[model samples]
Target: MNKSMNVFVIIALVMLSGCFPSNDLEKKQVHLTGITMGTVAYNIKYIEQPIDGGTPIPSDVVVHQNVERILKQLNQDMSNWIPDSELSKFNSHDSLSPVKISEGLRRVIAESIRLGHLSEGKLDVTIGPLINLWGFGPEARPEKAPTQEEIAQAQARTGIDNLMLEGNMLTKRIPNLYVDLSTIAKGYAVDLVAEYLDSISAHNYLVEIGGELRAKGFKHTGELWSVAIEKPVSTERAVHQIIIPKDNAIATSGDYRKYFEENGQRYSHIIDPDTGKPINHKLVSVTVIHPSSMTADGLSTAMMLMGPEKAYAFAEEHKIAAYLISKSENGFIEQFTVEFMPYLK
Candidate 1:
């Protein structure tokens, strides 16, 4: 899937997850570049402060090359949409044969399944049909919303329980079940890229793919990464910003993007699994910051589905920092969990 295809609605607005600025320093530097991986174009920045004649880090070519290799493998292995990809072949053949897969693919699939279970099936990978039926992807849409009977049939085939994983192999228990990793794939890929950069002993870096981002050590000037939280309306402006240090990930999920209007009603891309319809709630967007990219990605989506009040409670209970933008008759109301208040400055 082309990253461009994903409207910069929620997650993309927080791409600057890490942006540290040097304070009381004489020297300043920044490295800005872009790299294309799979179907997404990532904007990468490498900032470093020379420490008493410290040698410069590796060139941008090296970083791009490494990211390319990882992304290529991920795109090929984890993609169920591709006919010859490992997942596609497995789902197509419906065979229990143990297919060997790369470590990255294995980890991605495992984490996805775990999220599906932990979220009580709220975040499901077997929602490909739902996504397509609602015209969230490349599929055509019907002139009207899916009938109750059609939605029920799609809902029956969608669930985490339909997936069976044993060691390196995976098989679909339901014949029509198709897995779409759009919810977390980009975030996972960003983390993988960050890990590779860390492996090379490189710090002070920020990487963004389709607006999902991960930070390394610090900015070249030694300030936390500064990212903007977008207002949850149909505008291209950001109303607030958050600064985060290393070892944290942020993801946003909302319905402001990729929505269609029919009969004077708006239908968003976020599907309501229970009703097999686009979610219609008070929330416009939810941004989540966590220690893990996978957690950040999944929780953002789950909270979007859980609505405002429950999402606040859930975040508070989990000790997660969250910022939610909701729609009201007066305008947009901004709310945040207590955990995120410390970073409000």
Candidate 2:
């Protein structure tokens, strides 16, 4: 599957975004950058001063290797591109039987099911079949759009209810039920790296995988790190907002960049499970902030399924820090929940 099509958010990091004065940052900061999770680029940064005060710190080489190791293990367990990945194996399993999976796999699947259920089927990870039918997954773009019969057949294989988890054992109630965790996998990886850094007493750091990100503590400038949220536009990248993390992780979902058009009708890469087609609503973007990048990732995608009005009410009712943008006759309309006020620049 093309993992890049899973999300449309573009978050520009402050430290690297030229937000801070170049001559100001003189403190020792260890910045690590690499590509992982099948084309996702990430960079982790932390002040060496924090390690200086800790009991002992691993060498930079060890830290890099371990971080990449964690990412590699995660990919082996959950990535859809890896043919032998645990997730791919399970998807190929055409039996209604229980299969033992790794604890890490169980963790991500459990959260995905929970959020899928909570959102009332708005974010089903089991929508892989429909995704492929729409030519968004590993399959090539169909010569033409799928017929209703084809869509119904694929939709039958979806639904979070078809999946069940008993401890570390995950089961598929239907023989053809396929699961895909592309939506939330990067966020889980982000949290995993952050936890590992925390275990090493690296509190003052920022971790990002793809667009899902998390941060803690102040930067070398003795101030909290800020991140830029780009406006939802296909022409050019523009900063829509710059906000502090509030000691939380951030995830954004949008549909401007990934879509297909046919005969004047536009189809987004973000599928609506209810209809088994691309979302056609006016809500173009959704960004959420929470302590857990995984949760924020799930919520952002879930809110994208809900149009602007419903998403706004949902965020307010849940007291979630959400920023939503919708298309209008004049221009894009922006709305943020009260909880999101503190995050504004």
Candidate 3:
């Protein structure tokens, strides 16, 4: 497969069991699946049961419609590809003054800035220019690696320090700074869907967008939600580990896919903001489990950029539940933080 197709295959590694309940007393399962945010697929499963034992459970049509509406609104607010999206408008704005933004955009930008600080600018949203120059953003892919001068030009337009968020407004320190939230937006969408499910009394549900996911309560069989982490291999897909992420969100970032090889060297899409180039490290994948899918998503990317050793230290220091997989001469090496041990099945 080509590099782009390889990315889709690897991302499909997070498998879920769609088994339905057989017993009568067991809550009925409602599954909703659809495409959203470009090529990403979303799957939402929840138990259909009356909370008060009197009101009838919402029909499948109602739930599906509501979920789609929620996703559509989120995409409108955050999608950089959409010419009319709020983010796109902000990017096009040349003013250095603070520009008013919606509450949703404000929250996303604030969280991104916080993560940038936490990761010491490793997970920067302002690196869109570099990403585009490297043929990973909305721009068309280049036939070869970018030259040093081109990379330096893109790097000049990026820096976490160029972004500022205050209340419901965002300001750019420099007019040329471009921001992209593709790394964390999907995770935030998952969390938003989970919150919507909870608000509708859906205590037992699994929310997954792309490969990022959040699970709460239990399945119809009274068992916790099971998630599988994909083994990082280009030739074939396989499960590396299975875990019961009860009432938690899980996200994984890997470099085994979405990469191109030239002159016997590989260039991954996951760029290191420090060097303005693709990460060159033994670490293949990093998974994080947290209370918020948004946090897990951002942390996973940051940890992957740190590589195996630093990622392990960061996870331990911050008390983050994380799993790191690295490429080894013989095969692959697997490592998990102490906090992640409880979830392993």
Question: What lDDT tens digits, residue by residue, belong to model 3 across residues 174-292?
Answer: 99889999889999999999998887788778999998999987677666688888878767777777887878999999998798888888899998998899999889999999999
Which stretches of model 2 miss by more than 4 angstroms? 1-11, 15-26
Q: What's each prediction's clash count?
A: 8, 0, 0
lDDT of 2: 0.84
Question: Between the candidate structures 1 and 2, which one is better when assessed by lDDT?
Answer: 2
For model 1, how does the per-residue alpha-carbon lDDT over 60-116 read when each residue is reduced to its tens digit? 666677777877777787775567877676556655445576676677778888877
For lDDT, the strongest prediction is 3
Residue-level lDDT of model 2, residues 1-345, one tens digit each, is: 000122235555674332322345555678999999767899898766544456555766888999999999999999878899999999998988799999999999999999988888898999999889988887798877889999999999888999999999899999889888878988999999999888887777888888788998767776677888778888767667778875689999999877787878877888889999888888999999999999999999989988888888888888999988887776767888888887777
Flag regions of model 3 displaced more than 4 Å. Answer: 1-25, 52-56
Error of 1 at 56 (Å): 6.7
Least accurate stretch of 10 residues (summed lDDT) in model 1?
1-10
Colliding pairs, model 3: none
